[model samples]
Target: MRKNTIRPTDIKLHQKSRVLEVAFEDGSRFSLPCEYLRVYSPSAEVRGHGPGQEVLQVGKENVNITNIEPVGTYAVCLHFDDGHSTGIYSWDWLYHLGTDFDELWAQYLERLEKAGHKRKPAPAAG
Candidate 1:
């Protein structure tokens, strides 16, 4: 087996809305929405061992992570106001997310559309 390593080139925080802009040394960058990152989490709550096991996440249109706690030196645990913090996302996972962002995002939109759902922008805080 080959060993894989990833180093984050830069991470930008959108203080106003809680978005994280992550860029890698491989010229891959993605503006990861807080909500999107929360829902598509690799945790068992989102992903499963096989197909048809994925639970379509709902009511997460406005979820935002308030904190990110590191796990060991490879993964990070994201804490959201919605009380979701089970997923430990690794650097390799983050890299894949950033690299396939466009395609993955498009697929998400397509699924939502197929399900007759629409993406509403996150509401402004009062």
Candidate 2:
């Protein structure tokens, strides 16, 4: 284990709500939306091979996670309902996603706007 690495103590997938709730050993918890995870996937298909090669994800407003597979003790692979299952989300990366969600989401929205894409409104909870 690396120094200062935070590990998830519990992970819950709320299928109806379409969110992944993760609680860490450090007492931090995050509720990550499936669409957000899909768009920010660490897979080469989404993140690409290099910094400038990132392919912006679009039309993922209603995406959801269908399954979660453990990948050793270091990470977990998220299988999205849209058939995207290549991102290996590490503990550190998950923590980063949790802590930096606001900024990252803002950036994602900005990128979408710049690309002339408009996000659809979230579905109402019933």
Candidate 3:
């Protein structure tokens, strides 16, 4: 389907925590975790200078969405707490993420493990 072909049926903002929930008419509900949104951001800060050069984002579990901007009728730009707002999430990309969520999330976790990175809640109190 085309970008404009599928319009978001519902949109909600979970303010104070910076989350934007978008639901399409196809019964596809995207609860997209906030951290996932930040890490997978399509901006230069995360996408890096070129392919395979993406800087792995860590310790963003508590990072929240600050703002969400609509890009025409095809995409949405996200603003994060770290001030890294540059990526525009196209509808097609968002759809893929919503559809293949499980697989993509697993891949992210695996990559983190391979990199010796841990998604710890926080360092144990002393």
**lDDT winner among the candidates?**
2
What TM-score do all the candidates reach, one by one? 0.84, 0.95, 0.81
Rank the candidate models, highest lDDT first. 2, 1, 3
TM-score of candidate 2 against the unseen true structure: 0.95
Residues 1-126 of candidate 2 have per-residue lDDT tens digits of: 246889999999998889999999999999999999999999999999998999999999989999999999989999998999999999988999999999999999999999999999878988
After TM-score superposition, the amount by which residue 76's alpha carbon in candidate 1 deviates from its true location, in angstroms, is 0.4
A best-first ranking of the candidates according to their TM-score comes to: 2, 1, 3
Model 3 TM-score is: 0.81
lDDT of all the models against the reference? 0.79, 0.94, 0.77
Pitting candidate 1 against candidate 3, the one with the higher TM-score is 1
Q: Whole-model lDDT, candidate 1?
A: 0.79
Winning candidate number (TM-score): 2
Candidate 3 residue-wise lDDT, 51-83, digit = tens? 899888887776777788899987888887778
Off by over 4 Å in 1: 1-3, 124-126
- Angstrom error of the Cα, residue 45, model 1: value is 0.6
| Candidate 1, backbone clash total | 0
